[model samples]
Target: MKSLNDIKNIAIILTLAYAGITVTFLTYMATSVRTYNEIITYKEHEINLAFGYLFLIGMFTLVVLLLFLFYRAITISNRLLQQADRASGNYTIVESVELDKERRANEEKMREAKLLFDKEVESKLTAMLIFSPENLAEDTAFLEAIMLKMAKEFSAVQGLAYKYNKTNKAFELAATYAYFSENVKQSFTLDEGIPGQVAVKKESLKINNVPQGYLTVLSGLGKGTPSALYVIPIVVDSETVALLELAFFNNIDELLQQVVEQLEPKLGNIYAKFLK
Candidate 1:
């Protein structure tokens, strides 16, 4: 059904038609009364009655003209209504097409996201299932070998080692490998810096910013390039003994966190090895 506005327009056209009709009737009656009065006067020239009849004819003709014009206007309005309806339908079709395209685009994006998530899960699983303890020996040597293997596989940039020093209440460097150079300080003590902080707290440390000073305090592993570092400790018999540190290039960030998470469990039974 059409809205009230359309009905209102129709009502207005009806009212105008009524008004035109009323005017036409009033003009015809006025002309008849005037013609009668002029004919009754009987004085003056015959010219008066002739003129009055001509005026009456002209008024009647005008009423017909007005009705014809009104009819033409109604037809024009109907054509406009049809044009408007077609435009509205065209707009609706276009909107529906756009909605369908958007739905397909969103579905494609979701599929890609799921595939990426699955790939990452597979990568972590591969890293964790290296070897079962029943199939391999549980020794520090073996652990180190595993670490090395994983590092290579993961494209690790450096391997670091630290041992807690109860005597100085610090962690002392036991072994270190710097991929970039042989000249990197092969050893460091807790008194030296951040590695010590990790040792003192018995908590892992991950530094996102290798400030200029910390960068200068040591160099070579990632050079000034390691913007992030992870420190994990080796614990034995409820006492902290050693630490493992890895520095990554630029932002091996999320990957490093995953590596550390995977590394922690493997050290569960043999943490005693690095204490010596």
Candidate 2:
């Protein structure tokens, strides 16, 4: 940019010089023509002819100088335009790089914050379950309390717990929360349905975009269908002893899943000690 400015300054100086020289030449030629006219009125014809040739030559030189100045102006203008284009391109590239860096920084910060939040939630859940006391002998009541607590924490529309009966080799409905039905399926064998599948696999399952009429959330005001389903199997000694199912109006996110995973060990201990 500084160099471009220098070039502009030089161009200005040359233009001024050209203008001054043109004016001086024109002034001198005008005076000479006037003097020659007075002298030529009485001087030889040959002198008049020679003076005319000199005037034509001077006019030609002035025209050539004007064209050269015009061409120089055009050249300078083109160079300035090219320089501006290059500068603009460089600026865009720098701006893009800065924007990318800022975006990456923000993403990293979000990832860190998410990890911290997940740990905090896990810690809180651990404290609540680990430090509290309860009557584990009353299995039905215990299941109900667990469902209610989990529902409250996750904002679930409904929750259910199915205890595995070793003799029948089937999952029987143990407790329910915010669930209403004329007849609920009370039992499921291995690989029977979503709940049974989780129980058989001893793994959790999350379903999004729940099929219509799959499950409904009932309140005093009205009823609405749940949009998601989460089925988690409680395993002890490599045996799935029970299953917990939760329905939600929104999709289950990673935080909720993480909370459940964190609670697995404590839940396993509780199930191992309390339930058969």
Candidate 3:
């Protein structure tokens, strides 16, 4: 559990201790020889024997210190290697996590794109079926079916279909779907309301932020006002034959707009047969 700094300090102390011991041993050897030769030539041999033992102890201590220093160095190197391995493992885990997140994001984007493509294809097929040559008719039920289909497909809660009355010179409601209001008007003059304006101009219109009490959608739970309205004029041979009014609770999305535009010409062709 000792830190690297503590180990380094211990090593330095051992090195200094070894140096001091070596210097002391050398000084003792030199002084003992000089003093013994000057004072007692006969005891010189005994002094040499005692100093030899001391030298032997000093050398043993130095060897032990060297072995301990070498062991400490190896232990520190192993600790460093272990730390490096742990760091590398953690880095690899983090990299793998990041790659997983990127892969999930890409998968979500692909799914969204696929859903959009499928919806577009379905809308086109519905348009083709509704405008088929064999299905062309002036029946009120037929007109209502078209209106209901469009309302559901475009997320409109309610819709009304009006056909031009040539003799009366006005637009008369031919069909109504998902409507519960009793006071709904049965007919409109060319200059009367939003539908009337589209009829006179022979153009399509989209209205947002509808005025309060302008129109309401009814269900078993309750009734609520719509936030947006779409008035599409069905023209055939340059003559406005019908006006389709749809009410939605939310703003129309881009995909719905594209589908509606694509249906315009085909709906016109179907309306032309109704004129006959």
Candidate 4:
């Protein structure tokens, strides 16, 4: 009852063994033919008999050695191949937006939107990193910067983004791409909404139908339109400083997923700021 791995090893050993045996046998056979003629012509009885016995024993030994070597060689080779395959198995998920369709989505609009989005992300991240130590109490300034960027990218409609401040007990306007009532920027207490729950637990939460839930009031979002909202809490030094919230965007999560993987190590480098 050999294990699978053991059997594989044995197979390779047998292959090498056979190869070696075949080569040795062929070489011996060719030399023996000429030697046989010499033996008969010279009448060297003792020498001929000794050579004959030695040839037979050598053939037997070669066969056994060749079988052993072949199995070992192949088994080792197979195991190495399996290990190599495992090392390269990791893969990253890619968005499947059609290149032609997205390209034609609005060349000028897309170009402007991309530029705006890049500036917005850079702006937001830099501001948060800078203002985090100062204790950002209001979302007024931060959200406005993000919203301006979003508007430049997608002008068709407006978008809204928020962040939860557990200490302040409110949902601050993190970013918006459209105009909305000023009341929409109101904050909710720690015990008030799902954002608070997420902030406290330091985890993300999503609710599809906000009006039906008793969690918190969402004012000025243009009725029950933004049914889906994503709540992502940003932690600095293991403490939830703020929640980087976004609303009314279907593809934001996918984009964030990709960015998070890329941004993870980068955030680590910012440690150099504190070291010096």
Q: Candidate 3 — what's its lDDT?
A: 0.76
Q: What is the lDDT of residue 141 in candidate 1?
A: 48
Q: What is the lDDT of residue 20 in candidate 2?
A: 65
- Per-residue lDDT over 1-276 for candidate 1, one digit per residue giving the tens place of the 0 to 100 score: 255456556656755655666566556556664655655475743655555555566567556656865876698787787678767864357766986899899999999998886677567657655666642453444445545654666554566666566787765555555444545555456535666666556567777766654432235332345566677765566555777777655554565566566556556455554344
Candidate 2 on 17-45: residue-level lDDT in tens?
65665566566556664555554564545
Query: Which pairs, if any, clash in model 2?
Result: none
Clashes of each: 0, 0, 0, 19
Worst 10 residues of 3 by lDDT: 128-137
When 1 and 4 are scored with TM-score, the better candidate is 1
Evaluated with lDDT, which candidate comes out highest?
Answer: 2
RMSD of each: 12.9, 10.7, 12.8, 16.8
**TM-score ranking from best candidate downward:** 2, 3, 1, 4
Off by over 4 Å in 2: 1-108, 127-132
Poorly placed runs, candidate 1 (over 4 Å): 1-122, 125-147, 165-169, 179-192, 213-224, 273-276
CA lDDT for candidate 4: 0.51
Pick by lDDT: 2 or 3, better one: 2
**Per-residue error at 111 for model 2, in Å?**
5.7
Model 1 compared with the native: what TM-score? 0.45
lDDT by residue (tens digit), candidate 4, 1-276: 267577567656655665565566566567665655666554655555555556566567566756765876798787777677557653223322454456677897889988887776665445434434322344444444434433343221344555545556566665655445565545555544666677677665654453443222234553434444555555455645454444543334433443443343343344323323
Using lDDT as the yardstick, the better of models 1 and 4 is: 1
